[model samples]
Target: MNMNEKRFEEAKSKIVGIQRNREGIGTLQEKTVHAVLKNYYAPDVATHEVSLHNYVADIYTGNEIIEIQNGNFYKIRTKLEVFLEEHPVTVVYPIPHTKWLIWIDETTGELSKKRKSPVTGSAYLAFKELYRIKPYLKNTNLKFCFPLMDVEEYRLLNGWSRDKKKGSCRYDRIPVALFDEVVIERREDYLQFLPYELPEEFTSADLAKSAKIPSQTANLVLNILHFMEVVERIGKSSRSYLYRIAKDLG
Candidate 1:
């Protein structure tokens, strides 16, 4: 196994060991994915859940802060603002590169056969969450790490649809494997998200096609990029707005 794979295994084992010994630890209340990442990033328990300026950081490596956010980014905006004033903060967001769905019958507690989801995830999906914290994207001390993981998602078979699939509540996610990561530290690192095939001047539709993401998502990506000054609105094309990578991004 490669270094990442080895580290992942070690992280998983550390979480399992902690759970076995301390069942009701306050930090253990977080989902397995979050706990594993905390271990993966900062193995020293002393650094996990450190208090800084009245805010609890997921992991503080003495120099930098690492936050594992599995849900809404808005919730951490205040904490991030506090941390960013004095220290560099790296937000770790996990996207399921490959997902398997397992539905649990709430009534009988029986699990359905695991099936692979047709939807594959990419770093572009982060735009949705990033949009919530748009004002902080340009901060020099702020960075992002998108870890693509293979996971099994457990959901309850309680939804509005006839098959109880639509609007189902997610029980938890079990990380199966680590695929790769997209790390963005510098403003130039944002360029990695843009598709190589993109034209000099493009609309969200063109971006959506090249990035293989939905147009709505592409719009969000552009919004964040524009706010960061990575992209600028050059003009208009029909009903769509045209955008170009900023000339000073080099």
Candidate 2:
């Protein structure tokens, strides 16, 4: 089998193992999203709910801490700070590049409809939440991992929704495939995410146009870049700030 196919099977196997182990649990199993990833990344090398520094980390490998944050990163801001003090911490955030939406009727145990979502996700979305943990990105002991995966989104009908699909409640997300892993180990590594077409120095408008992202997003991207010391504001282009990569960094 090819390398990608091998990795795909490996990831799928991990999820299957987690499911088999949690067969008879009454309450929820610490979010299926987190369990699957913890198995995939640190399969046999880590311990779960390991306590250290007065905080219980999701997974610890004696030397480093790995937190599978399937939701907002802001919630773990304070906890992350405590871990970063003495040990390296890796935050794994999986972004679904392609998703299949499965709607189920709450009244009956039946699948109503299964369709692909028109909207696809990218690594860029990670930046939206990264803005909240901007200060932590610069820590030498901190790292961010964005795993692009193909996921199945389960929705229930009993929830209220204004949208026609009635996506009132999200049951769970199952990661079926792993495409690529984006690891940010250093502040300079973030520069690789920038567009090749970008000028040496440019405004948020220029970045927005070239990157095909909203101006507001461009602003947030710049905000994090500035805080990380990757770029510095040289001047102002009317209302927008002009920036260039720092001389010594990246």
Instruction: For each candidate in the order shown, give its overall lDDT on alpha carbons.
Output: 0.85, 0.77
Writing each residue's lDDT as its tens digit, candidate 1 over 20-76 gives: 322322234678788888888777889998889998999988889999999699999
Tell me, by lDDT, which candidate is best. 1
lDDT of 2 at 52: 90
Q: Pick the candidate with the highest TM-score.
A: 1
| Consecutive 10-residue window with the lowest summed lDDT within model 2 | 18-27
My TM-score estimates for the predictions, one after another, are: 0.91, 0.87
Per-residue alpha-carbon lDDT of candidate 2 for residues 154-220, written as tens digits (9 for 90 to 100): 7776655554355377777777778777888888887865788989989988888887878888888
**Model 2 stretches with alpha carbons more than 4 Å out:** 1-8, 17-28, 161-167
Which residue runs does candidate 1 get wrong by more than 4 Å?
Answer: 1-3, 16-28
* TM-score of decoy 1: 0.91
